[model samples]
Target: MEIIQTCDEMAMACRVAARPLGLVPTMGALHAGHLSLTTQARCDNAILAVSIFVNPTQFGASEDFSSYPRSMERDLALLEEQGADLVFAPPPEEVYPAGFDTWIEPGAVAEGQEGEVRPGHFRGVATVVAKLFTIVRPDRAYFGQKDGQQVAVIRRMARDLNLGVDVVTMPTVREPDGLALSSRNAYLKPHERQAAPVIYRALCAAEQLWRSGEQDAGALRSAALAVLRSELLVESVDYVRVVDAETMVGVDAIGEQAAMVAVAARVGGVRLIDNVVLV
Candidate 1:
């Protein structure tokens, strides 16, 4: 696999590669979840590219930006095994050059939940993703459903900006114990790892209520939060709301449209997020 760090080289590589290309944007620290996207993309497209850049702009002041995991050698090996044609692992200076002030402000889909919890998070995500879309110019971009709100934000941005790329969302890959796969999950200690699966269990509780005809959004949220609160290792709950999948607006009742039971919590100092669709 060709590993290109600079944007210009990556763009040229994409331009020269076969058509019907697919891109999987990631923050590195490759896991099965990330490989799942590439596996699907490889089957769907002739040319598959994966980006591994831990965007500094996405992290807040107290976040683990500097200490985030980086396994470039291992990531490249995995991407090569996944049949990736190009890997754009750009450096911070390359991604955000001197006097880089452009930022893509997202719409209502990015208003609450993570956007509120980590202020300007979606802005950074949108901007960096926009840049990646611009550089890669792939015919389709693959994302996982674990970052449900992020998928919504990127889809909105793509639709509004006329990026002409298909935003394909694959299923969220989970561990045998139901914990959603994430890069930050590496920070979880032994006991923290044991308690981490509670995040998904809480979402399952809300999902059970929705399946049993419990349509009240407040009750669904309460059901999920109660599960999280009952876990002694859970430090705090960020949110557990039932909201429209695309618009990210909380709904009062379940309608015909797609609704998501999403939850985010601080469990053993590691902030984890998970969700399940309740249509």
Candidate 2:
């Protein structure tokens, strides 16, 4: 896999390829989830460009940007195995440069869940994704449902800007015990690892409640919060929202159209998020 760090070189290389492209943007500690996105992109597009940049602007002041996992050697191997045509592992400085000023505002969609916790997070995400889209000019892009809020924000940005790229949302990949596969999962200690699965469990509980003819959003959220509280390691609940998947607006009742029941919590030092469809 060819790894290029500079925007000029990367853009020139993409131009030289002169083929339809697909992109899978990531913050690099490669996992099965990431591999799935890469493989799907390869199957769907003429060429695949996998970007592994750990974006700092997305994180809040106290967040784990500096300590987030990074293993480019392994990341490239995984992408190559998944048939990615190119790997762009740009340095933060290379992407941001000096005196970079503009940002993409996802508006109200960026104000809840992940955004509420990390202000300017979606702006950073939107700006970086817009930059990547400009550089790669991919016909399609892949994102995991694990970051449901992010997918919503990116789709909104694409629509608002008329970027003309298909945004595909893939299912969330999970471990056998049901913890969502994430780069940050590495931070969990031995005991906290066991507690980590609670995020998914709580989501599952909400699903069960929904399936059993309970459609009230507030009640469903309460039930999920109860499940999370069952586990002592859950320090705090950031949000337990039942929102329209496309608009990210809270609904009073789920109805025939399903809504996303999402949550974020502090498990020791790690912040884990998980969601399920309430149908």
Candidate 3:
């Protein structure tokens, strides 16, 4: 697979492709969830491109961007094994250059959930993703539902900006115990790793409550919080919210359409987020 580092070169490479291109944008700690996105893109498009840049702009002042996982060799191996046509692994310098002043704003859809915890986080995400979308110009782009708010933000961005790319969101991949796969999972200590499953467990509890005719949003959030508190490793409950999957505005009751039951907590200094959809 060709590994291009500059935005110009990456754009040129895509410009010459004869087939419909697919792009899987990631921060590069390749896991089964990431591979699933690439697999889906490969199946749907004639060519697949994976971008493995850990975007610095998306990280907050005290965030882990400086120490975020970086395994270019392993990531490349995984993408190559999955038949990725190209891998764009750009450094911050290459993508940002000097004095870069552009940013993409997703407006209010980014004001809650993950957005609330990591201020300006989604702004950075929206900006970098907009840049990647411009460079790759893919017919289809893939994202994991592991980032529900991200999916919602990108969906809104694409529609608002008329980017004309098909954004496909795959289900979150999890371990047998239910923790969603994440690049940050590498930061969890042994005991913290064990306690991390409560995030998913909490979401599951909320899902069960919704299924058992407990449609009250406040009751659902309370039930989920109770389950999450079981994990002593969790430093704090960042949030447990139910919202319209599209608008992201909190709802008083669950409806026929989908809603996000999301949670966030710090486990041994590593923050984890997970969600279950209420159908």
Candidate 4:
């Protein structure tokens, strides 16, 4: 696989490649969830390129930017095995130079949940993604449904800005026991790792209730919260909401519209988020 580091080199590589290129942007530390996106890209496009830049703009001052995992050697090996044609692992200076001042502002869709907590997180995400879209100029970009709100924000940004690339989303990949795969899963201790699956279990409980004709959004949220709170290892519940899938806004009732039950909580001092869509 060709590894391009600089923006100019990446652009040149894309220019020389075949048509209908597919892009999978990531922040190193390859996992099953990331590979799922790459697999889709490989099947659908003539050239599949993946970016592994852990963007600094997205992390809050207190967030784990410095401690965020980086495994370039392993990541490249995995991407090569996954049939990825190119990997763009740019340095921070290359992505954001000293004079960089521009940023993308994601509106209402980014104002709550992860956005409210992380603050300016989606703006950084949108900006960096827009930069990648500009740099790669791919026909389509793949993102995982594990980050549902992020998918919503990117889709909105693409449509609003006329970015012209198709934003494709794949289902969230989970562990055998149902814990959503995440880079931060590395932070979990043995006991915490065992406790982490509770997030998914709680979401599943709420989804079962939804399927059983529980239409009240409040009821669904409460049911999910109850399950999360019951877990002894859970430190806190950030939120458990039934939200409209498209707008990322909380809905009063499921009705005929698509909605999702999402949960964010602290387990063993490490925050984990999970969700299940109610179709």
Show model 4 residue runs off by greater than 4 Å: none
> Model 2 compared with the native: what TM-score?
0.97
**Each model's C-alpha lDDT?**
0.93, 0.89, 0.90, 0.93
Better of 1 and 3 by lDDT: 1
Which ten-residue region of model 1 has the weakest summed lDDT? 270-279
Better model by lDDT, 1 or 2?
Answer: 1
Q: What is the lDDT, from 0 to 100, of the residue 231 in candidate 1? A: 89
Higher TM-score: candidate 1 or 3? 1
Error of 4 at 71 (Å): 0.7
lDDT of 2 by residue, 1-279 (tens): 677888988888888774678899999999999988988988888888989999998988988888889898887777777887888888889889899998888888888888888889999999999999999888899999999999999999999999988999999999999999998899999999999999998899888988898888888898899999999999998889999987888899887775999999989878888887654
Q: After superposition, how far is residue 232 of candidate 4 from its true place, in Å?
A: 1.1
Whichever of 2 and 3 has more lDDT, that candidate is: 3
Candidate 4 per-residue C-alpha lDDT over 172-234 given as tens digits, one digit per residue, 9 for 90 to 100: 999999999999999999999999999998998888898898899998888888888899999
Q: What local lDDT does model 4 show for residue 164?
A: 95
